[model samples]
Target: MTTLIETFAALSDPTRLDVIERLMAEGELPAGALVENTQMSAPAMSRHLKVLRHAGLVEQRVAGTSRLYSVRPEALKAIADWTMDHRTFWEAGMARLDAHLALEEGEGE
Candidate 1:
Protein backbone atom coordinates (compact mmCIF):
# COMPACT_ATOMS: atom_id res chain seq x y z
CA MET A 1 0.00 0.00 0.00
CA THR A 2 2.78 2.38 0.98
CA THR A 3 4.71 1.40 -2.11
CA LEU A 4 1.71 2.20 -4.25
CA ILE A 5 1.32 5.62 -2.67
CA GLU A 6 5.00 6.36 -3.03
CA THR A 7 5.01 5.30 -6.65
CA PHE A 8 2.04 7.56 -7.48
CA ALA A 9 3.57 10.40 -5.46
CA ALA A 10 6.90 10.01 -7.22
CA LEU A 11 5.23 10.46 -10.59
CA SER A 12 3.29 13.46 -9.29
CA ASP A 13 6.12 15.74 -10.32
CA PRO A 14 6.33 16.72 -13.97
CA THR A 15 10.10 16.35 -14.16
CA ARG A 16 10.00 12.89 -12.69
CA LEU A 17 7.23 11.93 -15.10
CA ASP A 18 9.37 13.24 -17.96
CA VAL A 19 12.25 11.12 -16.74
CA ILE A 20 10.05 8.07 -16.50
CA GLU A 21 8.48 8.59 -19.91
CA ARG A 22 11.80 9.08 -21.66
CA LEU A 23 13.40 6.09 -20.00
CA MET A 24 10.42 3.91 -20.73
CA ALA A 25 10.36 4.72 -24.44
CA GLU A 26 14.11 4.88 -24.98
CA GLY A 27 15.24 2.26 -22.48
CA GLU A 28 18.17 2.89 -20.06
CA LEU A 29 19.67 6.35 -19.84
CA PRO A 30 22.41 8.05 -17.85
CA ALA A 31 21.92 11.22 -15.82
CA GLY A 32 23.21 13.38 -18.67
CA ALA A 33 20.71 11.91 -21.07
CA LEU A 34 17.90 12.50 -18.64
CA VAL A 35 19.10 16.03 -17.99
CA GLU A 36 19.18 16.72 -21.71
CA ASN A 37 15.73 15.31 -22.18
CA THR A 38 14.28 17.15 -19.19
CA GLN A 39 16.30 20.38 -19.59
CA MET A 40 16.96 20.33 -15.85
CA SER A 41 20.30 20.73 -14.07
CA ALA A 42 22.50 17.88 -12.97
CA PRO A 43 21.66 18.35 -9.29
CA ALA A 44 17.97 18.76 -10.04
CA MET A 45 17.94 15.62 -12.16
CA SER A 46 19.80 13.77 -9.43
CA ARG A 47 17.19 14.79 -6.87
CA HIS A 48 14.33 13.73 -9.13
CA LEU A 49 16.07 10.40 -9.70
CA LYS A 50 16.50 10.01 -5.96
CA VAL A 51 12.76 10.52 -5.42
CA LEU A 52 12.00 8.01 -8.17
CA ARG A 53 14.43 5.50 -6.64
CA HIS A 54 12.90 5.87 -3.20
CA ALA A 55 9.43 5.36 -4.63
CA GLY A 56 10.49 2.14 -6.41
CA LEU A 57 9.41 3.71 -9.68
CA VAL A 58 12.87 3.28 -11.14
CA GLU A 59 16.00 1.20 -10.70
CA GLN A 60 19.64 2.04 -11.33
CA ARG A 61 22.49 -0.07 -12.61
CA VAL A 62 26.11 0.92 -12.51
CA ALA A 63 28.11 0.67 -15.70
CA GLY A 64 31.69 1.86 -15.44
CA THR A 65 31.64 5.51 -14.28
CA SER A 66 28.01 6.09 -15.15
CA ARG A 67 24.76 4.93 -13.64
CA LEU A 68 21.93 3.97 -15.96
CA TYR A 69 18.30 4.31 -15.00
CA SER A 70 15.50 2.13 -16.33
CA VAL A 71 11.76 1.84 -15.86
CA ARG A 72 10.41 -1.11 -13.86
CA PRO A 73 7.34 -1.55 -16.05
CA GLU A 74 5.88 -4.49 -14.16
CA ALA A 75 5.65 -2.46 -10.98
CA LEU A 76 4.39 0.56 -12.88
CA LYS A 77 1.83 -1.49 -14.74
CA ALA A 78 0.62 -2.97 -11.48
CA ILE A 79 0.04 0.52 -10.11
CA ALA A 80 -1.63 1.61 -13.34
CA ASP A 81 -3.88 -1.41 -13.42
CA TRP A 82 -4.73 -1.05 -9.75
CA THR A 83 -5.61 2.59 -10.20
CA MET A 84 -7.58 1.74 -13.30
CA ASP A 85 -9.70 -0.68 -11.31
CA HIS A 86 -10.86 1.89 -8.76
CA ARG A 87 -13.96 3.71 -10.00
CA THR A 88 -13.35 6.72 -7.75
CA PHE A 89 -9.95 7.44 -9.24
CA TRP A 90 -9.40 10.42 -11.54
CA GLU A 91 -8.28 8.11 -14.32
CA ALA A 92 -11.57 6.29 -14.05
CA GLY A 93 -13.42 9.58 -13.82
CA MET A 94 -11.84 10.72 -17.04
CA ALA A 95 -12.49 7.37 -18.63
CA ARG A 96 -16.13 7.64 -17.64
CA LEU A 97 -16.37 11.13 -19.17
CA ASP A 98 -15.97 10.18 -22.82
CA ALA A 99 -17.72 11.71 -25.89
CA HIS A 100 -21.14 10.33 -25.06
CA LEU A 101 -21.17 12.10 -21.69
CA ALA A 102 -19.87 15.32 -23.25
CA LEU A 103 -23.01 15.58 -25.38
CA GLU A 104 -25.21 15.44 -22.29
CA GLU A 105 -22.86 17.75 -20.33
CA GLY A 106 -23.50 20.55 -22.86
CA GLU A 107 -27.05 21.03 -21.50
CA GLY A 108 -25.65 21.85 -18.05
CA GLU A 109 -23.07 24.29 -19.33
Candidate 2:
Protein backbone atom coordinates (compact mmCIF):
# COMPACT_ATOMS: atom_id res chain seq x y z
CA MET A 1 0.00 0.00 0.00
CA THR A 2 1.07 3.60 -0.54
CA THR A 3 0.77 4.21 3.15
CA LEU A 4 3.25 1.49 3.97
CA ILE A 5 5.79 2.99 1.61
CA GLU A 6 5.14 6.45 2.96
CA THR A 7 5.61 5.24 6.53
CA PHE A 8 9.05 3.94 5.65
CA ALA A 9 9.94 7.25 4.13
CA ALA A 10 8.62 9.17 7.12
CA LEU A 11 10.64 7.07 9.53
CA SER A 12 13.79 7.47 7.51
CA ASP A 13 14.05 11.17 8.33
CA PRO A 14 16.16 11.88 11.42
CA THR A 15 13.74 14.37 12.97
CA ARG A 16 10.82 12.12 12.24
CA LEU A 17 12.71 9.23 13.83
CA ASP A 18 13.19 11.37 16.89
CA VAL A 19 9.47 12.06 16.92
CA ILE A 20 8.71 8.36 16.77
CA GLU A 21 11.15 7.64 19.58
CA ARG A 22 9.56 10.25 21.77
CA LEU A 23 6.07 8.95 21.16
CA MET A 24 7.21 5.40 21.83
CA ALA A 25 8.59 6.53 25.15
CA GLU A 26 5.63 8.69 26.16
CA GLY A 27 2.61 7.00 24.60
CA GLU A 28 -0.32 8.72 22.90
CA LEU A 29 -0.36 12.48 22.71
CA PRO A 30 -2.17 15.22 20.91
CA ALA A 31 -0.44 16.83 17.94
CA GLY A 32 0.19 20.02 19.83
CA ALA A 33 1.57 17.99 22.69
CA LEU A 34 4.10 16.47 20.34
CA VAL A 35 5.05 19.89 19.06
CA GLU A 36 5.64 21.08 22.59
CA ASN A 37 7.55 17.97 23.55
CA THR A 38 9.77 18.07 20.47
CA GLN A 39 10.21 21.84 20.41
CA MET A 40 9.29 21.79 16.73
CA SER A 41 7.11 24.38 15.16
CA ALA A 42 3.48 23.34 14.97
CA PRO A 43 3.62 23.47 11.19
CA ALA A 44 6.76 21.34 11.06
CA MET A 45 5.30 18.78 13.42
CA SER A 46 2.12 18.81 11.39
CA ARG A 47 4.03 18.02 8.23
CA HIS A 48 5.91 15.20 9.94
CA LEU A 49 2.66 13.87 11.32
CA LYS A 50 1.09 13.98 7.89
CA VAL A 51 3.78 11.67 6.56
CA LEU A 52 3.36 9.31 9.48
CA ARG A 53 -0.38 9.22 9.05
CA HIS A 54 0.00 8.58 5.37
CA ALA A 55 2.32 5.68 6.15
CA GLY A 56 -0.26 4.14 8.50
CA LEU A 57 2.23 4.26 11.35
CA VAL A 58 -0.02 6.41 13.47
CA GLU A 59 -3.72 6.72 14.13
CA GLN A 60 -5.42 10.04 14.64
CA ARG A 61 -8.72 10.74 16.29
CA VAL A 62 -10.63 13.87 16.97
CA ALA A 63 -10.85 15.04 20.55
CA GLY A 64 -13.08 18.08 20.31
CA THR A 65 -11.00 20.75 18.58
CA SER A 66 -7.79 18.69 18.70
CA ARG A 67 -6.50 15.62 16.97
CA LEU A 68 -4.73 13.09 19.15
CA TYR A 69 -2.17 10.80 17.63
CA SER A 70 -1.05 7.39 18.79
CA VAL A 71 1.54 5.01 17.56
CA ARG A 72 0.22 2.01 15.68
CA PRO A 73 2.21 -0.87 17.09
CA GLU A 74 1.04 -3.21 14.36
CA ALA A 75 2.78 -1.15 11.74
CA LEU A 76 5.94 -0.86 13.85
CA LYS A 77 5.92 -4.55 14.65
CA ALA A 78 5.69 -5.37 10.99
CA ILE A 79 8.69 -3.16 10.28
CA ALA A 80 10.60 -4.66 13.18
CA ASP A 81 9.91 -8.18 12.06
CA TRP A 82 10.84 -7.34 8.53
CA THR A 83 14.11 -5.83 9.70
CA MET A 84 14.76 -8.77 12.03
CA ASP A 85 14.69 -11.13 9.09
CA HIS A 86 18.01 -9.57 8.05
CA ARG A 87 19.09 -9.26 11.65
CA THR A 88 22.13 -11.51 11.52
CA PHE A 89 24.49 -8.84 10.24
CA TRP A 90 23.60 -6.28 12.89
CA GLU A 91 23.20 -8.84 15.65
CA ALA A 92 26.57 -10.33 14.94
CA GLY A 93 28.17 -6.91 15.17
CA MET A 94 26.38 -6.22 18.43
CA ALA A 95 27.48 -9.53 19.88
CA ARG A 96 31.06 -8.69 19.06
CA LEU A 97 30.71 -5.27 20.60
CA ASP A 98 29.24 -6.84 23.72
CA ALA A 99 32.15 -9.20 23.97
CA HIS A 100 34.60 -6.37 23.50
CA LEU A 101 32.98 -4.29 26.20
CA ALA A 102 32.86 -7.21 28.57
CA LEU A 103 36.52 -7.89 28.02
CA GLU A 104 37.42 -4.27 28.69
CA GLU A 105 35.30 -4.20 31.83
CA GLY A 106 36.79 -7.44 33.09
CA GLU A 107 40.25 -6.07 32.51
CA GLY A 108 39.43 -3.11 34.74
CA GLU A 109 37.84 -5.36 37.40
Candidate 3:
Protein backbone atom coordinates (compact mmCIF):
# COMPACT_ATOMS: atom_id res chain seq x y z
CA MET A 1 0.00 0.00 0.00
CA THR A 2 2.83 2.37 0.84
CA THR A 3 4.51 1.56 -2.44
CA LEU A 4 1.29 2.30 -4.26
CA ILE A 5 1.07 5.69 -2.59
CA GLU A 6 4.65 6.45 -3.51
CA THR A 7 3.99 5.45 -7.08
CA PHE A 8 1.00 7.74 -7.29
CA ALA A 9 2.93 10.61 -5.70
CA ALA A 10 5.84 10.24 -8.13
CA LEU A 11 3.44 10.23 -11.08
CA SER A 12 1.66 13.32 -9.77
CA ASP A 13 4.45 15.42 -11.27
CA PRO A 14 3.85 16.15 -14.95
CA THR A 15 7.49 15.77 -15.93
CA ARG A 16 7.83 12.44 -14.17
CA LEU A 17 4.56 11.18 -15.66
CA ASP A 18 5.75 12.22 -19.12
CA VAL A 19 8.99 10.37 -18.57
CA ILE A 20 7.11 7.19 -17.67
CA GLU A 21 4.86 7.52 -20.73
CA ARG A 22 7.82 8.07 -23.02
CA LEU A 23 9.74 5.16 -21.58
CA MET A 24 6.72 2.90 -22.03
CA ALA A 25 6.21 4.05 -25.63
CA GLU A 26 9.89 3.80 -26.63
CA GLY A 27 11.37 0.70 -24.90
CA GLU A 28 14.47 1.25 -22.77
CA LEU A 29 16.19 4.55 -23.49
CA PRO A 30 19.40 6.13 -22.28
CA ALA A 31 19.29 9.04 -19.87
CA GLY A 32 20.52 11.35 -22.63
CA ALA A 33 17.79 10.23 -24.99
CA LEU A 34 15.19 10.96 -22.33
CA VAL A 35 16.54 14.47 -21.91
CA GLU A 36 16.21 15.38 -25.57
CA ASN A 37 13.18 17.33 -26.86
CA THR A 38 12.46 18.64 -23.39
CA GLN A 39 12.90 22.22 -22.18
CA MET A 40 14.38 20.98 -18.89
CA SER A 41 18.12 20.56 -18.36
CA ALA A 42 19.74 17.14 -18.14
CA PRO A 43 20.20 17.51 -14.40
CA ALA A 44 16.53 18.33 -13.95
CA MET A 45 15.53 15.27 -15.92
CA SER A 46 17.94 13.21 -13.84
CA ARG A 47 16.17 14.34 -10.70
CA HIS A 48 12.80 13.29 -12.10
CA LEU A 49 14.22 9.90 -13.04
CA LYS A 50 15.58 9.51 -9.54
CA VAL A 51 12.14 10.07 -8.10
CA LEU A 52 10.68 7.50 -10.48
CA ARG A 53 13.36 4.98 -9.61
CA HIS A 54 12.75 5.49 -5.93
CA ALA A 55 9.06 4.88 -6.44
CA GLY A 56 9.81 1.46 -7.98
CA LEU A 57 8.01 2.49 -11.14
CA VAL A 58 11.21 2.38 -13.23
CA GLU A 59 14.43 0.41 -13.32
CA GLN A 60 17.82 1.69 -14.39
CA ARG A 61 20.60 -0.24 -16.08
CA VAL A 62 24.14 0.68 -16.90
CA ALA A 63 25.20 0.16 -20.49
CA GLY A 64 28.73 1.43 -21.16
CA THR A 65 28.56 5.06 -20.10
CA SER A 66 24.82 5.54 -20.38
CA ARG A 67 22.06 4.97 -17.84
CA LEU A 68 19.20 3.09 -19.49
CA TYR A 69 15.71 3.30 -18.02
CA SER A 70 12.65 1.10 -18.44
CA VAL A 71 9.30 0.78 -16.74
CA ARG A 72 8.92 -2.01 -14.18
CA PRO A 73 6.13 -4.32 -15.31
CA GLU A 74 5.09 -5.19 -11.77
CA ALA A 75 4.42 -1.58 -10.91
CA LEU A 76 2.12 -1.20 -13.90
CA LYS A 77 0.42 -4.46 -13.04
CA ALA A 78 -0.24 -3.26 -9.52
CA ILE A 79 -1.89 -0.12 -10.85
CA ALA A 80 -4.07 -2.08 -13.25
CA ASP A 81 -5.07 -4.54 -10.55
CA TRP A 82 -6.00 -1.77 -8.18
CA THR A 83 -8.13 -0.03 -10.80
CA MET A 84 -9.92 -3.22 -11.74
CA ASP A 85 -10.59 -3.97 -8.09
CA HIS A 86 -12.45 -0.69 -7.86
CA ARG A 87 -14.20 -1.10 -11.19
CA THR A 88 -17.56 -1.62 -9.54
CA PHE A 89 -17.30 1.72 -7.68
CA TRP A 90 -16.51 3.65 -10.84
CA GLU A 91 -19.28 1.99 -12.82
CA ALA A 92 -21.81 2.68 -10.10
CA GLY A 93 -20.86 6.35 -9.96
CA MET A 94 -21.13 6.68 -13.73
CA ALA A 95 -24.51 4.96 -13.72
CA ARG A 96 -25.85 7.37 -11.12
CA LEU A 97 -24.52 10.33 -13.12
CA ASP A 98 -26.19 9.05 -16.31
CA ALA A 99 -29.53 8.57 -14.54
CA HIS A 100 -29.39 12.11 -13.16
CA LEU A 101 -28.64 13.53 -16.60
CA ALA A 102 -31.50 11.58 -18.15
CA LEU A 103 -33.92 12.85 -15.53
CA GLU A 104 -32.76 16.44 -16.13
CA GLU A 105 -33.34 16.02 -19.87
CA GLY A 106 -36.83 14.64 -19.29
CA GLU A 107 -37.73 17.63 -17.11
CA GLY A 108 -36.76 20.00 -19.90
CA GLU A 109 -38.83 18.11 -22.51
Question: When superposed on Cα atoms, how far off is each prediction in RMSD?
Answer: 3.7, 3.8, 1.6
Per-residue CA lDDT of model 1 for 1-109, tens digit only, reads 3477788899899999988989889999998888886566899999999999888788999999899999887768878788678847775668778765887888785
Candidate 2: pairs in clash:
none
Could you give the candidate ranking by TM-score, starting with the highest?
3, 1, 2
Model 2 lowest lDDT segment of ten = 1-10
The TM-score that candidate 2 achieves is 0.71
TM-score winner between 1 and 2, please give it: 1
Regions of model 1 farther than 4 Å from truth: 87-109
* Maximum-lDDT candidate: 3
Q: What overall lDDT, based on C-alpha atoms, would model 2 receive against the true structure?
A: 0.83
Candidate 1 residue-wise lDDT at 35: 88
TM-scores of the candidates are: 0.75, 0.71, 0.91
Rank list by lDDT? 3, 1, 2
